[model samples]
Target: MSTGVSTSTDKIIVDKSRGHRNKAVSKAVRQTRERLQSGHASSSAFDRDVLQMYVTAVLQGAAIMPLFVIIVAALGTYFAEDASLLFWALLTLTCHTANILLARHARTKEITAEAARRWRNLLLAGQFLIGCCWAVFALQDCAACEPSSFTLYKGATLLIALSVTTMSNFMLTPAVLVGFAPAVVALAARSGLSRDILELSLAGVFTVTVVFFNYISDRLFQFSLKILSFQSEKDDLIAELEVAKSMSDEARRRAEEANLAKSRFLASMSHELRTPLNAILGFSEVMSAEVMGPLANPTYKEYAGDIHRSGQHLLDLINEILDLSRIEAGKYELSEEAVSLLDITEDCIGMVQLRARAKNITIHDQVERQLPAIWADEKSMRQVVLNLLSNAVKFTPQGGEINVKVGWTAGGGQYISIRDNGPGIPEDEIPVVLSAFGQGSIAIKSAEQGTGLGLPIVQAILAKHDGQFILKSRLREGTEVIAILPAKRVLQSIPAVEQARPVAKKRRSFA
Candidate 1:
């Protein structure tokens, strides 16, 4: 199997089972939530909410309806001749009382979707009984008054009742219809049999009024339904957000634990691994130098030199890994002091100068005069500079050029820039190279491969000092890495105040 040069840290897991069990579970949860919000015929949450609104409205208006009927009956005793009007008012009040008790009881019960139907029917039945009382009220002729006047009186009372019911019970469409439709039909039937033209006209007008208000009531019902739907949708969205938050928290906890475990393992094994590495380096160096005596076989001497170089390379890789792990674990503390960027850069260049000379690479150093010392970790800064310079020397082709610069930043800070005219990193692969152990295609194919920790270490060190790290590169153009220390980190030296020595004359004047 041939592996690709570029790599990613993501992991993909595939699970194939009978119905994709995980998806099935999620789908079930979604469908159940939707059903609870939308179901109407059954006792769903929507039905229960609407029913609760209806019950509450009826209970609130319970006393008003009785007060109205008693006042109208008292007025009838003076205006009309019918003694039966008092009895009708009493009966209507009784029906109102029954409905109020029923509504109050329903309000106290837990009405779910399953029981919403039963509760609604009971409420509608109570309302239909009230409509029967209104039907009886429509029959009173008020024989003591003029025929036309009585007709107007009857029509006006019915209109008021229709308006009241439509307002109080509009949430339930059936309640409105059963509460008032019987009275409209009764008045129409009574006026037709009497064959009175004036009475018939008033009755027709009353019917139209009832129809118009019912239409308005329907619009109210739709609007209320829309409001309820919006409310249900809001509740579901809040639930989903809560679930997502919990899942995110869980995943974060797991990631932190795994990272902690990795740090512990690396820390514990560091000493054990380095001890053997030191022994290997010592033995290989002794053999390569032949310090005890000269080797008889030339092939043996060549092998010893290879062993020494390989051991040194392994030691370097081990050190880089441990440094990166410590940085990630937040255990790498900065021993901060005032350090000069020019001095550090110059020293790093010297350290890599022999390697660059072996490859015929020219390094040009540019320094801004009078650069300020920055408060930062000295050892970490040296590591950052050396890693960048080493990379430049390793990648720059024979006789290529590298430019190094140290200068004051525009924001009264300091920066170190290292640029190499080698095979530049592909723009898309810059992130890959910056990640831990993430080598780009160029690095993977290079003759001198690296552990891919150089830039990451440099970035981490700069971050510890509250500085910035920027890497810019293009395909075959060049690569430049800038490490910037903020203005706050630049230790600006204070000018000492110059003052002449105070003369002793003040003491003589006091004496």
Candidate 2:
């Protein structure tokens, strides 16, 4: 029983020992893998960790290369006097070559992502080369040094340290960060833990932070500028669209107004042509009646005369229509000549006297004895006066007065005026009456027959003469129409050839 128990205990102990050994082997394997990875990540030329490692290496190499060289020389002196100078010369050459390599790689390039990365790679390679050379020198020096004595740099080590400082400081931060990291790490490790290493580490951290911040700021500013430019272009397009819309609206309004004017003109012209035809037809039917006897019946003879007169009146209306149409179509021009204003006014009144007498209205003429001759178309001016007198006689009530006045106005113009006691026009409706085919509001409600083209003709005629028509009217009191024209003397090349003649001496006269 004792042997069995002892065998079981031995078996258990052996199994436990094997398990412990396995774990120990596993841990050792893991540690070795971790060390290899760390070494490569930190010291490899292409690795990001090289920046820290390289900077450490540089400071440490600088602080201790002087001591290492001294120790190597001392050992050489003790073993072989001639060999010390040979080794020293070889060390100097190696240090200078590494520095030159570093300097050659650290040049400015175009700023871009790919270029920045390439810069980092180049700097790292340069730093790694420099560090490796210094490491080899340090190892060799330490190998020859005494255990108890401290070593300092010789002339060769001093040169290496100075060259590295120049390269690291002169290179831009992005390049320097990648190149100087390995040097810094090595320097920290080998420099006996000095304050100089701490200062250098802080400097490294600050430089890298500033460089990254500046790069980010530049990118943000570029993005903002692009956004502002796009917005400005958008605003300009919107303004152009608004202007186009406004122009389109204005053109549409003008087209509509032109169409409306065309429709109104057509309607008025149709009415004018039909009105004269009705009178012609009515008068012709009456004249054709022979029931009252043709040769000797006075009543029948008067009826025939009335028919003839009506036919002539219709012909006159037709002729006026043609004249108005020609003027409106921009074809009529004034045949200017010296005209007698007094004679024109008297003829107009004589023509409309029968119509005024039928309404029992009184006609009065007020003329300065002899008026100055005016520059006007004699026939057109006579028609203007006749139209005014006829209109006054038509509207005036029985026993009401129609007054005709003609003279040279005090304000340097010739004027012919017709005044009547009649229902007058409203202020707001006056302007509309002056328009073609437009008439007064009162005319719309009355039994009066008008073609609505009279005033338009009057206005057209005055415009051709370069003259003005003035209307003064008050509701229920009276109305006055004035035709003002530039005096004819202004156009005369001869100074009133008959100025002293008795015919021209008087200021006003009758026809």
Candidate 3:
């Protein structure tokens, strides 16, 4: 029974050992494959980036190598036989010079797949040759040296070689191995030749250290490759973003050019178009009034009146188009002056009153009394008031009421609001109504269709004055349009005490 238990325990231990061995083998194989792949992979942009980095490291190391060589030569002269000092110094200098030339050459060349492989191989070869130089120094006998002095010299040389190679060439794992393998083998062989337990143990420890360094180098290479890949992707994304921004800028410039061209075309044709239009209106009016002679048929006078009205409407549309074009082209220069808002509002109301009366629409004017005058363009302000009133009159049904108010805003700005209780615009269609040549469904189906320029022109003019225009409407309820002039445009009044006093005696003297 005891034997059976022991057998079972042994089997279990064997199974665990086998599993561990398999795992170690798998790990080793994976690491080997990775190293091989990294060494022989075809060059891409990323590979070039890695090569560039490697060259930079080499250049930096080249600078330090000469200093190291000088220090080692000094030490050898001071502590031991100086016989081989010149030979070692010359070899070190030559190796460093060669490495510098190679690194610079690699930097100058545009790396391709085949070229990259060749460069890497050359770099590895250079490193190996340099390692052999150090190895030759380390392997040389120092019979004149004391035991402690010899130990110190050997240890220093080996440490320097390992550290330099490990740090400078770690980004390329294969390069690290090739560069330091000779030095490590030479040191191990030298240590073993002593046949002392401590020396052999030291050699074993160094071998382990070399393996550790190689492992670290491999990991570092992978990490550096990942970082470079991420940087490349980031560069690509930045390039694409720059391209998109340039295209958007170009499109914007083209659109502006097209708009300018349309404005120029319209401006050029204005005089020619208005000349015929004025003639048509003038002749139609004279015939309708029968000022020269009586018409042969009474119907002829009515036809002339219709022709005159149509011509007038066409003239108004043309004028609206021209004004809108000028505004869009940034050519509408404001002629600034002190103007009374109340006066302008009254004039606009008078102009639209006849039309409002035809529809039986009631216009309620609620203007503030003794309102301050504003610094603004007189003609533009008049047009703004007129456009708002006309829109109200046009949209309001018979017997519907419109409220027009001119008052001070909360911000001390002056505002004119015109509201109509008629078939208001749909909320979704408000933007359409405000755009140039845009009309809502309700406005389209109405008895009268405007040129759709009134609101847009008003909005543009307000914007030019650094003011704001707001339109609010709801379907089947009402619509309100407000034009606000900023407080900065409000002209301050003189003090009452500053007024000139009347002369009381002037009237008596005249009598």
Candidate 4:
């Protein structure tokens, strides 16, 4: 117990010493939780990761982008018979291909948080270059077709291109605006030059549509960021929980090892301690009794008697420590047999009777007769009875009453209960008193004190027998302790077998 206690204490001290590490982990977790709760989960630290995803997305749809550009140009050239549309298509394809090459190169390179802004600026620049190609396309006049129809066709082409850019490049925050805003501005400018009302209205509607798509793109990016943040938080929580579990397991294992070492040390040293102790007791007893010769001085005999009593006390303490250690170490093996619970309780009462008489304490015992013997260790039962009786005697005031009971339990088990009208323990200190080497306020104030292993040993012994030990106490009222044996341990009387006499004569007469 000492070694285990020390080890736990040391671990606590070490944990305190390294509390900074725990605080840092807690801080990160706290910040993450705050961000989520405050609806600010889109951390700037994840920008690099988002950019990486954006680069991959743009490169994936690279072939399709150039195809759309060529198709739009070809459609316009068919309707308008314009060579300018062809040149515009060629220029757009070149710009779109360059953008693909840039994104692919960025993907191959290591993208770090520090380099994220640089890469982002570079990609936005490429988008603006492609937007320039769209601006040039917006200006191509359709001379071979009706003016209104060509305007419609041109408007449709620009809208389609803007829609495609928005839906695909929404992962990047400014991509939709950078790639299409230039074209929208060019259309507005062309409408202003024409000085027509419908053209101005069309230009205004195009600007509004562009703004709406950009807003939608930003919202989608936010939604994706929120989902990623949640995933990252979950992963961190699980990892921390695993680490905590591992630390707990390690601490438990180390504590067990320390307890084992303590038990082993105590077991090995018990004999080394008791051998000299035995000689001291023997010699002191002889001197106190004056077996060989009478003592010259009364004080000398008194000193010898004191020595004997002190040695006995030391022996008792050692025995209690060893018993508790064995029980805690799971090494206490019970010697089982049929023992009369009633008989054992009576004997222990008698043993403590003289001490009760010394204090003028009256003991009232109630015994239920016709009780069967129970399957238990006789020595353990005796020890259990004695410990309860001894505790009753120690706490009982002079002229106080002690009640000892042996009876059948409600569940058909055997129970021995000892109650004393003494200064009872406080409700809070009951647990403390029940622990090893713990004492209550009453015990601390009294002349009588013990190693405090008595109740614990009794509890452990009952547990081994598959029984139960209960202590009930109230402040300034009284205390009662009950030790119960389960019904399985109750040995019932076996009925005798009746023998058949002269059975052969009856069998001969039977059909």
Candidate 5:
């Protein structure tokens, strides 16, 4: 009932804070994405410092290995009189110089992606160049060697390593695998040993295995991140749905309370109205009979008759209102008993026949010859039939036919159809016909005054009995109302004989 409000100062502060938060989050997200896409830039302190340290360590390690080999080879040349000591010494010196220059260059600044890729490629090219130069010198010593093919194959392996490493720095394993494996094989084949082919095949298999492992690891890491993201989103959506469900439940509870309050208010109003109405009718009847004095003229008597009739009508309306309130409160309970459908139908027709006769309308009863016993409260069934029949009589035109038919159907159900040759309901208004205080479009336009609670009561009663009420109509073709009731109570599992025996014994004792 109350409108929500926000003070101007609070609104301004909230708006400003929200805008600032949105801008900050957007900027941070963009920067993080950009950094992930691009490689490290120059002058980044962390990158320069770490790369420099790593490059220094790598050069130191590279020199130690080559230095050990050079010293060992020199000793071998001196002791065993080997002829290629000069070539071996020059090769070691060249590798040391290249490592020193690379280390110094790395220390100067951070390595950008482009610079890293370029230098990596150049280093691979140098490895191939040095291997080829050594192989060429070996070929000259052994004339049977085809040194050019081996050199070309080694160059291809180096190119593959460079390409793979550029694609991903994490591809280090694959890069090292492809780079060295083929070169080792080429070296073996050039040596002209009989087992060299087997060694080359093993190296090829080893390289493929390394690449396979790297691919599987990369895929696994990606899949893990994706699964975590999916679960987080699912949890957030479930939380939102739970909040919506709680809000809906609260709204439903409030609606039910409002409906109960309305029913209670109507019941109280009806009670208050009926009290004064009874006194008015009672005093009018006394005056009409001249308990105090006789009417002065015949016209006065006619006026009194109108007042009595109107009073009765108002009483009927009040009773209908009270009955509807009881139905809404679920205070109208059915007391099951055996009653014949034929009897009820005939009785209802007899009650409303005079009203039909007043309008020259014929009330017809076509009850089935062998109607089954229905389980219901006899008084309530009487009310249901009377209300329907009376309503039919009120709406029937002169010479119009009112039909009441009863029959036993299959599935152990009894049906009573009440039909009348009256203006039928509009098709679109059919759904609202049973709703409380709602009427058909045609009914609204007509002069007939009704509380509009009759069908709602009928529906509620039928629902209590676990039965059904159906309406079918067409414009200018009359309307049919069907009430279906089960032949038996479908009582709980307690035996009927056990229930009857107690009543029979009591009757015998009384007798």
Candidate 6:
């Protein structure tokens, strides 16, 4: 039973090892495919950035190496001879100066892929030479040196050199390996020449450390590649957004120009169009009334009346279109006045009462008495009331009730509300009703099709007065439209009778 248990454990371990090996092979294959595909693309920018980072690292090492060399030279027991110490110092200084100059030159050069490759080679060569100079210390015989001192000196120098190169070149895996391989080889060779068990063991440990650092360098390289790729994608997205914004601005500008042209055309032709329309309406009315002479046939009179009505309707439509165009073009100028809301509402009610009576629709009005006058354009205010009442009468069913109310608002403003019980607009079609030349689905199916500019004109006029217009409706229920004049537009004043009775009230005694 114990043998069988051991066999099962061995099988599990073997399976795990095989799984790891397969995973590694798969990863290597995917990486190779990616490299082959990416090789065709231009990597100039990536190369430039990598080269810049490399130059920076090289410059930093040049600054730090001279200090390290000085410290090592001061601590070494064999370097008491002035000539030998000076030779070592000069060699180290020369290598450092050459590397500094090379780094500076590389930094100033425009980096292409070829240029980056050349710089990498030059950098690795400089590192190799610097490593050789340090290795000479390991090769030097210190006759007065204790075994402990010699070991300490060699280990410290090699470890410090390894740390510096590893940190500097870790961004590029191949560069790191090439730059530090010489130093690793030198240390291992020196250890073997010493023929000491402890030294050989230390050398093996150093080689293993170098391999571990190389692994870390490869990981850092992959991380940097991912970061760079992400940055590239971010830059592309920003460019696309900028392009979209520019296109939107251009489209908006073109639309404004086209709208301006249309407004100008309408303004220019208004007189020409209205003159013909006025003549047609005038002549048709005269013929229908038989003012000049009796018509030859009764049917001719009826046709003439029809012509007059059609002409009048056309003129009203043209006027509405012109008004909407002016408002959109920012050309509508308000003729300001103090207009009584009650009086305007009454006039509008009287104007539309005939149409409501034709449909047998009862018009109910609830207006607050002595409502304050509003500062507004009188003609515009009249148009606003007429449009609302017209829409209510048009949409209200036969024998249905229409409610018109004018009163003070909760915010100390004046408002007019017109409601009708009819085939009310659907909620989704409300926006359509509000837009110019847009009608609800029900309106489209009705026998009376409107020009659809009435509500938009009313909205525009109210907006010009710094007021708000609200329309609320639910399908098959009812529609309510409200026009509100802002509080600032409400005039503060006393009526003539009230002002005249002030002296009489002052003379009266308190009851």
On lDDT, the candidate that comes out on top is 4
Instruction: Name the lDDT value of residue 97 in candidate 6.
Output: 87
Across residues 141-238, which tens digit of lDDT does each residue of candidate 4 receive? 87788878877777788788888888778888888888887888888899999986766776788889889999999999888898877787676667
List the candidate 4 regions with Cα displacement exceeding 4 Å: 1-42, 492-511
Better by lDDT, candidate 6 or 2: 6
lDDT string for model 3 (1-511, tens) is: 1212344533443343334544554565555445444543323545666778889898877777788888888888777756687688789789879988989988888888668767877888888888788777767666687765566676666666677777888865577667667867877887778775544654576567767778888888888877776665565456555655555665565567567556655765677678898999999999999999999999999999999999999888989999999887788999999999999999999999999999899999998988899999999999999999988888899999999999999999999999999899998999998999999998899847669999999999999999999999999998999999999999878877877899777545554
Off by over 4 Å in 2: 1-320, 488-511
TM-score winner: 1
| Global lDDT of model 4 | 0.85
CA error at residue 496 for candidate 1, angstroms: 2.4
Q: All predictions: root-mean-square deviation over Cα?
A: 6.3, 30.9, 21.1, 5.1, 13.2, 19.0
Worst lDDT 10-window in candidate 2: 40-49
Model 4 worst lDDT run, 10 consecutive residues: 1-10
Which residue pairs show backbone clashes in model 4?
A: none
Higher-TM-score candidate of 3 and 4: 4
Residue-pair clashes per candidate, as listed?
3, 40, 0, 0, 0, 0
For model 5, residues 107-133, the per-residue Cα lDDT tens digits are: 575677557655555545444444443
For all candidates in order, the CA lDDT equals: 0.83, 0.59, 0.80, 0.85, 0.61, 0.78
After superposing candidate 1, which stretches have Cα over 4 Å from the reference? 1-45, 108-110, 498-500, 503-511
TM-score of each: 0.87, 0.45, 0.77, 0.85, 0.55, 0.77
